[model samples]
Target: MKTRLGCLSNKSDSCSDFSEFLPPAQETAARSLKLSTDEAEQWSESFDVLLSHKYGLSAFRAFLKTEFSDENIEFWTACEEYKKIKSSAKLVSKANKIYKEFIDVQAPREVNIDYRTREKTRRCLEDPSPTSLNEVQAKIYSLMEKDSYPRFLRSKMYQDIINRTHAKCQRRSV
Candidate 1:
């Protein structure tokens, strides 16, 4: 069954219901994102809390897509992946790919960042340290935490999820 939860990739515009492409285990995990009412309510405890929950993160990603600013989250997640590269060659390649895909000016999936942070991130690419994207990623995180995250809490989509989860909980208790 097709669910409303599509656009699981960084490039949201080209995304289809690509959940079908997930490995069986991963697909089961995706389909298993049944957030309880308390879990849904815990989303408002903090932005970090929301991001830490897979269900909350997926919901937030969908919310970001509606706001047309999913790129910020995408960039944030890309930096996360870039930071995990243990091999030097892999690190460099991933850093360059991230820069081209989300950091370079007019990148295909360019994130919203000021020129100063952009330049700083660009300069870091020359040295290509593991922490090269840290500052820029932090900025993006701040942006989402301050701006998008608050709005997400107030979004109708979020409200609907809470209501759905609550209803599910109620029915189970009955």
Candidate 2:
């Protein structure tokens, strides 16, 4: 069966009078997708391929009609609004995904021993002390002027030295 697409004759000088296929939703769809400028142009070509395959010459002529239509200006304007809405939706979806991951992996903070070791090393450098307990305390107090030198060595490595000093102090007290 032969499809009669649009009317065309020598009587009408303007080409706007003829149109008999789907109006260009290609431009509208591309803009609504909020594609980049380069992407939009590439999309236009792809849209033409799809339309041409679907409707052939009839769709091609309809595209010309849209190029000169005053009433369809609103259609193009609506496409821009659709683009904004679609872009915002994508951004919101991405944010929600990150928030969900954060909630899923929520855990309590763990005490970091590496950080503690580094702090202790820095203190030792600032206040170099002798191997003996009394000399170490005197150096720590004289150099840094802080109370309770025994409490400063709280890590497991220094616990034995602190225990020995406590025993010595206990014997002297007796």
Candidate 3:
């Protein structure tokens, strides 16, 4: 049986091609989160930590991309941006765009929210508020925290960072 990550195999070629646009991991690691290795481990254990850290968020995004669930994070971030819109007109337009792109049933990047959450979001769009997607976003956040976060902690990518950080620290102390 093909897994979600397995399904992304067809996109690997494109992912590789596009990856060239990504900053080097070292740069991303240093600039993105700015957390120490110990802090990174701690951040990996909690959603709020990861969300607060740019590097944690970037790493999580990379992990989600591998699983083909990057849409969840993307949708959540879009909702955050939508919430920050000051112009009423822009709020409505951006909210609708986000809905059609990630919340709509046939959306190309549909997230794994429940029907009730989806329906609630749709209703919220009728009179869009900054808090419109708050509930659904929380759900998505919980899903990532509970499911993907643990896997990320165990991932080789994460481990390698921890190892490198430890080695660097040891060198400094010695």
Better of 1 and 2 by lDDT: 1
Once fitted onto the true fold, the runs of candidate 2 whose alpha carbons sit more than 4 angstroms away are: 1-4, 9-19, 23-87, 91-174
Tens digit of per-residue lDDT, candidate 1, span 34-144 = 557788799999999998876677678777877889899888888888888899889889999999999899999998889999998889898798899999999999999
CA error at residue 140 for candidate 3, angstroms: 0.7
lDDT of each: 0.77, 0.29, 0.72
Model 3, range 41-145, lDDT digits (tens) per residue?
777656788777765676678778877788988988898898899999999999889999999999999999889999999999999988998998889888888
User: Candidate 1 vs candidate 2: which has greater TM-score?
Assistant: 1
Model 3 scores a C-alpha lDDT of 0.72
Candidate 1, lDDT over the whole model: 0.77
Q: Give the Å shift of residue 142 in candidate 2.
A: 81
Instruction: Quote the positional error of residue 58 for candidate 1 in Å.
Output: 0.7
Lowest-scoring 10 consecutive residues by lDDT in candidate 3? 12-21
Candidate 2 residue pairs in clash (backbone atoms < 3 Å): none
Best by TM-score: 1
- Return whichever of 1 and 3 wins on lDDT: 1
- Candidate 2 residue-wise lDDT, 90-123, digit = tens: 5345333322321122412111124444344335
- Best candidate, lDDT-wise? 1
